[model samples]
Target chain A: MKELYSLSAHELQKMIAVGEVDPATLLDAIFDRIGSLDKKVRAFALADKTKANDRLKRASEKKLGRLYGIPILVKDNICVKDEATTCASKILAGFRPTYDATVIRKLEDEGAVLIGKANMDEFAFGSSCETSCYGPTRNPWDLERIPGGSSGGSVAAVAADETIAALGSDTGGSIRQPASLCGVVGLKPTYGRVSRYGLIAFASSLDQIGPITKDVRDAALILNVIAGYDEMDSTSVDVPVPDYTKSLTNDVKGLRIGVPKEYFIKGLDKDIENSVKKAIDVFKKLGAKVSEVSLPHTEYAVSTYYIIAPAEASSNLARFDGVGYGFRAKESADLIDMYLKTRSEGFGDEAKRRILLGTYCLSSGYYDAYYLKALKVRTKIKEDFDKAFKDCDCIVTPTSPTAAFKIGERMDDPLSMYLSDVYTIPANMAGIPAISVPCGFTANGLPIGLQILAKAFDEGAIFRAAYAFEQNTDFHLRKPKL
Target chain B: MESIDSKTVRHVALLSRLSLSDKELEAQSRQLTSILSYISKLNEINTDAVSPTSHPLTSLKNVFRKDDLKPSLSTDDALKNAPAREGDFFRVPQVIEGK
Candidate 1:
């Protein structure tokens, strides 16, 4: 018998609709699975069964919304009113948000039960989950290897069947890269397709909340619920929310797919390179019109992102001072002393490093040289996508240059870690939508991700391509030995 | 040609309102030096003709809501997460040199 916990959100929804499965029994199975495998995978910062049960009881009494009675894990950075929403950093320790993030509100309004708080990089600062205060979330495929992050815990949870689906925030590959490494479906929607009202701000401009799920259809299902305009977020676009499931039909025939030649470079792992190339061939076989394209400015994505993301992060993070919420240093002699001491003690090394770097970029005389110059380069990056998208319905590339590395391998090397985001950052830069799907696995069994990039608010195209590719392959069906 | 030395790092840390120990400052100086050096590569691209993009969607403008009072968060809920609270306010260390 297929384990109840191993089923997808759609499957669970159907079973419950037919009265073949009880919602409470499903929750019990989910928590039971998490109870056993989480010690090895370490996917959550907090998995409160008590609170989930309370939510389950309440949800049972509600009318059916799209995701009725299905369990979902939310990234710690997204606020769940009256529940701990720490961003896996000590600074926000003991902080429970006073209100729900719009996405959280949307999910629960659809009868989706919030199961747990997923672990992440401290303040979403690092590429590896190692930077989180709760320690690293290991990849289910190989516990010794790292799960690509800062959404590592969310992705690992979904990959390990810890939950039916999860919500994660992507600020330059936090969602896609980790999804790639964990061999699951992750999508970063067009910049404003989803509201960012209650998500803890990282780099306000680059950060977006997206779904990390077991397959592309689930991604579409979650996006259907969460993607829409809200009065709360100014950045959210006033676009019509399409029934994304309608785009899930496996038909890529005559679709224009762009293959960026720049992504095939020396540093990309041979296995990943081959797997992505193979994914392209699969697309061609399915009648996708594939041809070489150039995103010439791609070389500058990481450097440009470092300048812009940090500058905004430094500004956004200024809110974490001791006065209002979260950790506060009590012994300080005065206000300024308290601010400095509280921040110094509460933040981890990576968070401190990013704060310093961001401050330096936007600081005094260096602003024009670093910050302004980066913004100009960002225009070029956006233009590259614009010119390429003119002829292509979507673009394809490896989500990361390499697969999951050892946990501590790049922790000491921040630059190397930053470069891993090279392929995934461009979508955020252009405010375009992108998805990462299971393309193949490495020789040692770590999965590789095939990323698809579609134009702004054209997430329907991404869903189409990703769903088609997923249907034509069995990579997503392979489970970890755990 | 700019490099991040300890003095520069300390100044930046101060600006960031973070108090770093000497060891952390030294390590930060080294790491920031390398990171900033890497970021400087943007200079290679001739972006003189391009306009800077602060946000990707240039179409979005100012967003406003109706000028009516809604049922906002109750003071108790607002102060619920405050590390130090006094009655309806968040209490903090004295500012502006007390009288």
Candidate 2:
């Protein structure tokens, strides 16, 4: 029998359905693996075996649902009732939600055992996992390098086999960037495709919750469980969701793929560039038409994202003022004084920096020049995708400009840290669906990622392309020498 | 682009309902200045005729659900995560002015 911890969620589900592996035994094996490895990987923020067992007991009695008995982790940013969903920030310390996030409820309905909460950037802010209040999650590939973030813990957990799959939120490439760095599959669905009812808001317009898994088919299978409209999230579109697994037909024949010339410019690591170009060749050889498309506003995406994301974040984060839940200040003379003290003491440096920047942008005088200007540029960014997609079925690029960097390499220079996400942020800005799958490795043994993006509601194209690529390569099959 | 100084940082922090230490103010001033400088690169693009996209990619907005008294959180559940609770209410900081 295959080691339960090492198999994909779908494979494990099949075994559990046939009674070849008891759900509790699979749970114990995964917990054992997490026990041995998580000390080095640090993927989980709250991985209590006792709590997971209790949850598993509850899951066993539910009606037979898809993905029954499979273990999945949730990113700390997404609320799980009776569990701490801190977004890895001190401000949210000691807080537990009374209700689950929409994704959590969906997974519970599928009878999947909710194992734990993965760590993340403090309020999903930084690219590397360093800004987490609990500290950074190290790459399973190399313990010295960082697991890319803000969904670092989710991707790392899947890579290190701490959990079979995970749920992560992407705002400006949080999910895809980490998946690239960790050599796993990460999908950021089209905005409004999945409900955001209880996801702790970061950048509301840009955020989307999606799956992180070991393989493309697993990604599609998990997407099947999570994708759909909910009245609770007003932004969720009431579009018909097709069976995503049906789209995983290992063929990309006649598919039109665009290789954006703008993404292959300066500052992109040569190994990643070579890997992505080779990936494009594979698509071409598979009878897919490839063209050198241009997304002219590509260079401006980072700048525009910095402004618009922070502006929205400032407003969304205003709720954490020591009023309803989470941490509160010790003593204060007045209401304003308490609010100030609690926030000052609770939030980390990155959170404060962003809050100040947002406040400055949305402040009276600068609103038109900064906030409104950023929004206008956002329209142009989206227009760039709209034009490119008109000429192609899907677009391909390198996921992160480079593979995972050494810890503390970009910590001092916030701008450099922000730049690490340059290749992955455009999808979020355009409100499109994107996926990252392993393509190759660097000389230093670091994994490289090939990103595939499609028009909104066309996640099918991305899955078809990615599955075709994965079927031809052994990259996804290779695990880190952990 | 206007530079972020300690005075501006302090004022912005106050507006965010967050008080920063002298060190944080100094650090944020230096960091925010550099970030804003990078964001200034957007000034090169001409967006005079473009409109803002403030919502999701969907056309749906102002989605009003049918007005009904559906199941809501019990008062105990609502106060579950609160730092402190006095019966049904969350114990917040003093809001009134009088002693």
Candidate 3:
């Protein structure tokens, strides 16, 4: 029999609803699994043993919501009432949010148990989870390697079956890259599909929240609960949300799939290239029409993303001046000194580097030359996607250039670290929905991800294609040997 | 492309309100120079006719809410996370020269 923790959220929900297992039993099995394996994974920033029990007690007496009694992990950047939402940064240490993020509220309403807060790159600033103050989350596939990050801990936990599913925010490739490396299903909804009311700001414009799960159907199920508009977030769209699970059809016959030529270029690993191409062939055999499409501005995506993300980050992070909340520096003689001391003492190296880059880009003399020019290039990048979508229903690419690299390998090399996000950042730039599903594995057994992107609010199209690809392959069924 | 030096890094760090040591400044200057050089590739593309898009979505407008009363956090909950607090206000280093 499959272990309780190994079951997907949908499977657990059905089991609980049919009275085969009680909420307490499921919770106990998960906590027990965490007790056994979390020491190797280090996937959570904070795990609350008491909270899930309280939720279980309440769930037993009621006809639970759609995610009835299922345990789920949330990325630390998202707020959960009375829980420490540190975003894996020491600056926000011991800070407990007084209210829940919109997604957390939605999860509660759907009867999902809040199991723990997963670790992340500090303030969602780095590609690898190494920048996290809590330390890096190791890849379950090989403990020597990193789980690709900022949502590294969330994806790692789900891949190891430590949780049924998780919620993570993607500002560039935080969700998809890590999900790809960790061998799980991760999705980044259209920019405005999910509300960002209480998600800690990284780059306001590119940030979005989505799910990481064992398979694509669970991703669709979680999206059904979290993807919608909320009045509190001004950027959230008012479009009516469809039941995403209905999009999980195995027959993707006659669908148009666009394989972008830009993503399969130099520096892509041969193994990853082969796996993604093989996955595309499966789509073709399923009666889907495949064609090559060009996203001409693709090379500029990393440059444009770095400029816009950090520029916005510099402005948004100015709120952490050691006044209203969080860490405060001691021995400051005046307010200005306090601001300087507090921020310098609190943030990590990568954070400071990006902040400086942002300050320089937005400075008076360089604003037009750097920030403004990048924005115009961003327009071209988005237009590239727009024109490409005119010819294809969905675009496919490898989620990362390579599988998870050894920790500390690119720690000192910032540009090489930035290049890892090359294939995944354009979707965020275009404000479109995209997903990463396990396509195949490397010879050493590290997972490779196949990314599928659709036009805005066309998550159903992404789901249909991803589901069809997943059902025909055994990649999603393979578990990491722990 | 212009090279980032220690002096420039100091200026940028001051603007960002981050204090750094000399060693940090030197190291960061080297890294930033390389990163900036890489990003300079964007300048090669002609964006003369392109209007800068600050946001991806084109349809966003100013969202307004009615001025109706709503339940909000209590003063205790609001100040719960503050590192330093006095009564109902946040306590911080004095801004003015003297009282």
Candidate 4:
């Protein structure tokens, strides 16, 4: 057999379950893969080889849980007891959590070995990985391009074989966009479907922790492990968790998919359009009906998301003042100087930009004009999706406008950066489940992702539809030569 | 309809607690103005009677549990690695003064 690192998470788990392979051997292979590729990709922030070995030893003793020694990478934003959870920001450079996040506890209970914390854009603000206090994560496909972000490290790590699967928090396309750019699968579960007890907040309402993996089956497996209600999180849903893997069978005979006309408009790249259209054709081939649907509020998604996400972000990040947690200025002339200098130095440019925009929108004089108005528009966006769901089991769109661009291409243009999320933001705003699956590559060899969104708590529909598409296409089977 | 100027940029920076330099303010002022103008397209849509939603799901009730004091992080453990720390507390410059 090939190196264990070369296999998908599902393949590894199945082999281990049948006693064809041992956890020790797989753990060593994972360590070796991380040692080789992580320096170039800058995938992980903190790794404890000793702890990983301990977990493997337990697995060998037959004391292992469901995941049983599968090497997993966690986004730096999620808290793991006794490990640094920096969120890739200087503000929390050495901060460590005393208690594990609820998801971490659940994963540990399943005997999944956490290999390390992956890097991300500081405070989960940037769409590209470039804004991390540590550094940018490079795409495995093309070293010169980005793996979409702020979950870029998690996405890049899986693509580069540093880990078979990883956890990422999605707010405004963070998980799905990076997965699209990196040519992997990223799932953003419905809001409140997973516990937010340990995730450092970026935008509480929009954020949900989900999985990014090499394949759809692996995403389903990870979702089953993490999705549940938790007493620790006030926003957690009380719904019963379903066996996500059970829905992966290629049986979408009567599923109806809606392709929004607004998403195929002029700004979308022709290559991406073709790739998604081809994916729809694949769905049609697999006994599903694909029809054109109108979502008129699509144009307002980017504008509304920018306003609403940041408005909430501005409030959530208020806890990071110099007085409480995170960074404080070295020497301050006065209280005001301390606050100014600490925040000025603590946050990256993107974080500051959002904070300012959010603060502007939420200011007393502007609240009724900007923030409140944006919320009303947000309702319309959700209503549009609610209306569309009446005719379709799931909605389909291009995960992003184009494949990964050159490193510095959109970094300097804030509006252009915002435009990158045009396709995926509405799903977050609507609190629906969405998955980004590889569809095809562009003429330039960059991968395109087909995004599938389902109604609230209907991740089963998303998995069934995505699995159907994955089964009908060869895109998910392709791997980066590197 | 809106063009953000240096004054608005300064005000926003103050609100966000960022100490932007004059150079940054000059550049960001133009950038913010363009973004705000682009988003002002919302002004064209008449939404007089529609109620704004703060959360996506309106059915969510207050999901809080009773505040119980579990084991707190020891003061030493909490402040051990702080960049700037004082005895049993995080030392910061005074934040407010008496009127």
- Give interface RMSD, every candidate, in order: 0.9, 1.2, 0.9, 1.8
Q: Identify the candidate with maximal lDDT.
A: 1
Query: Is candidate 1 or 2 superior in lDDT?
Result: 1
lDDT for B45 in candidate 1 is: 83
Task: Put down candidate 3 lDDT per residue, A1-482, tens digits, no spaces.
Answer: 88888998888878887898787888888898889999999998978779889976665566678987889999999999888888888788778899889998898888888999999999988788999998899999999999998999999999999899999999899999999999999999999999999999989999999999999999999999998989989999999999988888898999999998988789999999999999999999999999999999999999999889999999998988888778999999999999999999999999998899998999999999899998899899999999999999999999999999999999998989999999999999889999999999999899999999999999999999999999999899999888
Q: DockQ of every model listed?
A: 0.88, 0.80, 0.87, 0.60
Question: Which docking band does candidate 3 fall into?
Answer: high
- lDDT tens digits, residues A1-482, model 1? 79998988888889999999998899999999999999999999999998999998887788878898899999999998888888998889899888899999999889999999999999898888999999999999999988999999999999999999999999999999999999999999999999999999999889999999998889999999999999899999899999999999899999999999999997999999999999999999999999888999998999999989988988988999988899998698889999999999999998899899999988879998999999999999999999999989999999999999997898878899999999999999999999999999999889999999999999999999999999999999989989
Q: Which residue runs does candidate 3 get wrong by more than 4 Å? A: A61-63
Best first by DockQ, ranked: 1, 3, 2, 4
C-alpha RMSD by candidate, in order:
0.9, 1.1, 1.0, 1.9
Model 4, A1-482: lDDT tens per residue?
57688788889888898999887788888888888787788878877788889866765576667788798999999998878888998877667787899999888888888889998988898888888999888898998898889999999999888888999999999999999999999999999899999999988888999999988999999899999999888788989999988998888888999999999887888999998888888888888888888889889888888888889998888777667566677888887898888888888788878888888888878888888888898888888999999999999999999799888888789899888999989988889999999999999898899999999999999999998788777898787877
User: Which 10 residues in a row give candidate 3 chain A its minimum summed lDDT?
Assistant: A55-64
Tell me the TM-score of each prediction against the true structure: 0.99, 0.98, 0.99, 0.96
Select the stronger candidate by lDDT from 2 and 3: 3
Q: What is the alpha-carbon lDDT of model 4 when measured against the actual structure? A: 0.87
For model 2, residues A298-319, the per-residue Cα lDDT tens digits are: 9998988888888889998899
Q: Indicate the DockQ of the complex predicted as candidate 1.
A: 0.88
Encode model 4's per-residue lDDT on B21-43: one tens digit a residue. 88888877877777888789888
Give candidate 3's error at residue A160 in angstroms: 0.6
lDDT of 2 by residue, B33-74 (tens): 999999999889888888887765647657789999899998
Return whichever of 1 and 2 wins on TM-score: 1
